[model samples]
Target: MALLKRDFIPVSKQQNMKPLHYPDCIHLSERCGCDLLSISECKGESCSFCQSAAQQELSQREWLSILNTLGLEQQKKIAGKYYSGKMPWKSQQKKG
Candidate 1:
């Protein structure tokens, strides 16, 4: 029921050359053991993360597709957890 390395997400950095920030650092997924992109900062895109057997080529939509493919249960759980039962949230919080 956790978003392990199989659900790793790309880490994005701020605009001022600061460290990358994860919007949801408390979720089970944030603990994913995937290697982060540390060599260079993300341009908000043009970066990627590997989720176990699946590698997302730096598209947020692609990552979400993987979750949806995990099955309806997972998709619902994720949507209820972070999306506020709506489109992706611009802010990260357990709104619903």
Candidate 2:
């Protein structure tokens, strides 16, 4: 099941930048919290907790969808000097 934007409860970034502890992740529930802040990035393909990376892929897709909503100007401002109009993924697609 794909996660909708409604699945998340937006909290102030400053208030929860670093959580005191990581609660057990419950995928598809409203109680789901951001695990990125507390855990190290990993492939997670073999992690039982990630259900063979399904959770990882779902989270990535959700975040990327939100990012894609940004206009070129907004994206450029965030990307700073590296903000080429063309993304690396687009360039790679052209080469192949």
TM-score of each: 0.28, 0.33
- Write the residue-wise lDDT of candidate 1 on 1-96 in tens digits: 213222334455643333433322122133332236443322222223323222233344566556645766766677787877754532322232
Best by lDDT: 2
Cα lDDT tens digits, model 2, 4-87, are 233233468666443332223443223443344344432232334543255566765665665557897766665565645545
Task: Output the lDDT of residue 54, model 2.
Answer: 58
What's the residue-level lDDT of 12 in candidate 2?
81
Model 2 Cα shift for residue 96 (angstroms)? 14
**Cα distance off (Å), candidate 2, residue 12:** 49
What local lDDT does model 1 show for residue 68?
48
Query: What lDDT would candidate 2 get against the real structure?
Result: 0.45
Worst 10 residues of 1 by lDDT: 24-33
